[model samples]
Target: MDATVFEQIRLMLWDVDGVLTNGDIFISAEGESFKQFNVKDGVAVALLAKHGVKTGVLSGKQSPALSKRCEQLGLDIVMTGIHNKIAALSAICKELSITPKQVAYIGDDVIDLEVMRHVALTFAPADAHMLIKNEADVVTQASGGRGVAREAAEHLLMSRGLSMDEVYKPLMDAWNATVVVQ
Candidate 1:
C-alpha cells in the first residue's frame, strides 16, 4: 500500500501454519498434530527481538507447540485460535499503541488477506496462494516453513540497517570456540 509505511514498521506480526509451516496438516489417529519449523527462522526471530524489533505470531488454529516456541523466543505477543485475524490484528495494534503504518504482517492464505490489507508492509511466501501473493508487498523467495520467515526477517533487518552477520558473529564465534574445546 503505502511505500513510506514500509520504512516505518517497528513491529512484525506473523501467521503460523502457511507462513511458518508448509501448510501441511499432519494428524495422528490420536488427534495429535505436528509441524516443522526452520532453524534459520528461529534465529531470525531471536535476532529481531534482540534488536528491539518486536515480533509475534497469530494463528487461526490453536497449537500448544506454537505457544511453546513463541515463549522460548521471548516474543512480544502471541495470539492463537484466531479465526478472524483482522480483529486480532486490530487488537494487537491497539495494545501496542502503534498505527497500521508501523506494523508489518506476513501471511500466506486467503484468511490473511484482510489483515494484510491493513498493515504497513505485507509479505507472502513464494508458494502462497496467487491472491495472497498478489497482495503482498514482499513475496519471499523461499516457500513457507522452508526459510521464508528468515528471508522476510532478513529483508526487514536490512531495511532497518541491521546486518545479520554482525548480529550473529558473537554466537557463531561462541559455537566455534565450544567445538574446539570439545
Candidate 2:
C-alpha cells in the first residue's frame, strides 16, 4: 500500500462486528449479550473526524452498544442492520456528496466483499477471514478489537503529511477553551 492510496480517502467506513470488535458475542448467564470495543479505535475515530476525514460504520447487525459508541464519537454515517452493503454504500456516498473513489473501507468478513470492491482502498485486520485478507489493500498488523483503526488513521494522516498530535490538537484546544480559569 502506498501513500497515494490513503491520500485519496475523504471518507472511511467500517464493519462493526469483526472490524471494530473481535467478532465474539458475549452472552451472560442471564441471557444478556454484550460487546467489548477498543478505546484506541474510538480515539482514532474522533481524531480523524477532527482532522477533516469523515467516518462511518456499516454493519449487518443492529446494536445499541454500537449506536451509543458512534454517538459518543460523532461518526458521520452509521448504517446498521444492513443486508445489502453495496446499496447502502452507494446511498451513503450520494448523501455525502462523495464518490466511491474517495472512500476507504475496513472490514473483516465475506459479507463486506461487495462494498470493499467498490472502494478506493480496503483494509483488513490481522485476524480477518482468509478471503478478506487475500483481497485487502493492506492487512494490518493489529488484529480486530485492538488498534486496527488507529493504524489505519495513522496511515491516512501520514499520507496527508500530518501527525497524531496534529489531529488531536483541535480537541486539546477545545478542552482548554472550555476550562474555567480559576
Candidate 3:
C-alpha cells in the first residue's frame, strides 16, 4: 500500500481471465474460446513500455487469444496454463535478473494471491472477488476488461513522481515537429 512500493516497480505482471476478460468465457460451436480485451488496457501497456517498464502475462488457463494478445502487445514474458504462478513468477524474475520486489502484480481471483503477495505492489479490479480485493494493495476503480490497466499505469507513474505528460511528451514533440501549415 505504500507509495514507495509502486515507485520500485519495474515489471508489471497480470493474470488473464478475470483481470482481462471480466471472467467470461465464450465458447463457439467448434469449442473455440474467445476473450475481449480493452483497447485502453493495450494503450496502458504501450505507455508502460514507453516509460521503460516491462510487462508480462501469467495465466491459469490456456487460450489462443491470450497468446495473440501478448504477441500484439509485445509482451515476451508470458506463461500460460499455469497452476503454480509463484514458481512461474520466480522463474520470470530470475530470467529478467530482477527480484520479486521489482514486480507489480494485478489479479482478480484467488489463484493470484500467492504471486500478488510476493510482488512489490498488488492491484485488483474493482469487481474482483471480495476476498482477493481485501488482500490487494490497490483496487482499481475500473472493472476488469475496462480501464483497470490504465488506472494502474497512472497510479504507478504518480507514485514515482512521474506524469502521463512525461510519458507522452516525446511523441507529441515528434508529431509537432513533423507538422506543416497547409
Candidate 4:
C-alpha cells in the first residue's frame, strides 16, 4: 500500500514452496519429498548478499533439503515449520534491526497474506494463486521455482543502481572467450 516504504526495502523474505520452488511437492515411493530450485536464483541471492541486502526464507513446511539449500546460499535467516508467518516475520525484522518498511516478502498461498500485509513490498510468481497475486505489488513473468527469484533479484539490484552487465562481465567474458576460435 505504501509505495515509498516499498522503495526502501533492504531485506527480502521468501516462501519456499511457491516462491522459490514450483508449488509441486514430489514425493518418491520412499516418501522423500523433493523440490526443484533454479541455479540462477541461488546466484541472485548470493549477489544480493554481496550487495549488503539480507535474504531469508520462511516456510510453512520444514524440510532438510530447504535447510541445506539455505545454508548453501548463505542466507541470513531461515525459519520453517512456522504456522504464523507474520509472527515469524516480525521476529526476523527485530533480530535484523530492520523496519517493516525495509523488507519485501514473496509468497504464493493464502497463509502468506498476513506476512505480505506487514512488509513494504510483496511479490508473487505468475503462477501464484489469484488471491495471492491480487495482494502482490508485482507478479513476475517467470513461474515459481523457475526464474521468478532471479527476476525479482534483478529488479532489486537495478533499483539500487547496480548494473547487471558490470557485475556479470567476468562470466560473460568467459563465455565469449570459449566461443572464440583461434
Which one wins on TM-score? Answer: 3
What TM-score does each of the candidates earn? 0.85, 0.87, 0.89, 0.85
lDDT of 1 by residue, 135-176 (tens): 999999999988877788778766655577866655466654
- Sorted on TM-score, best first, the list reads 3, 2, 1, 4
- TM value for model 1: 0.85
Give the Å error, residue 37, model 1: 0.7
Candidate 1 Cα lDDT to native? 0.78
Q: Worst 10-residue stretch by lDDT in candidate 1?
A: 173-182
Residue-wise lDDT of candidate 4 within 1-182, one digit each (tens)? 43455458889889999878888787777664667788878866755665567888999988767777887777888898899887888899899898888998889988888888888888899999999999998899988988777788777766656578855554455654432110
Q: What's the C-alpha lDDT at position 143 in model 3?
A: 95
Using lDDT as the measure, the top candidate is 2
lDDT of each: 0.78, 0.83, 0.82, 0.79
Distance (Å) between predicted and true CA of 108, model 4? 0.7
What would the C-alpha RMSD of candidate 1 be, to one decimal place? Answer: 4.1
Report the poorest 10 consecutive residues by lDDT, candidate 3.
Answer: 173-182
Comparing 3 and 4 on TM-score, the stronger one: 3
Q: Which stretches of candidate 4 lie over 4 Å from their true place?
A: 1-7, 161-163, 166-182
Mind sharing the TM-score for model 3? 0.89
C-alpha lDDT of candidate 2 relative to the true structure: 0.83
| Model 3 segments more than 4 A misplaced | 170-182
Q: How far off is residue 3 in model 2, in Å?
A: 3.5
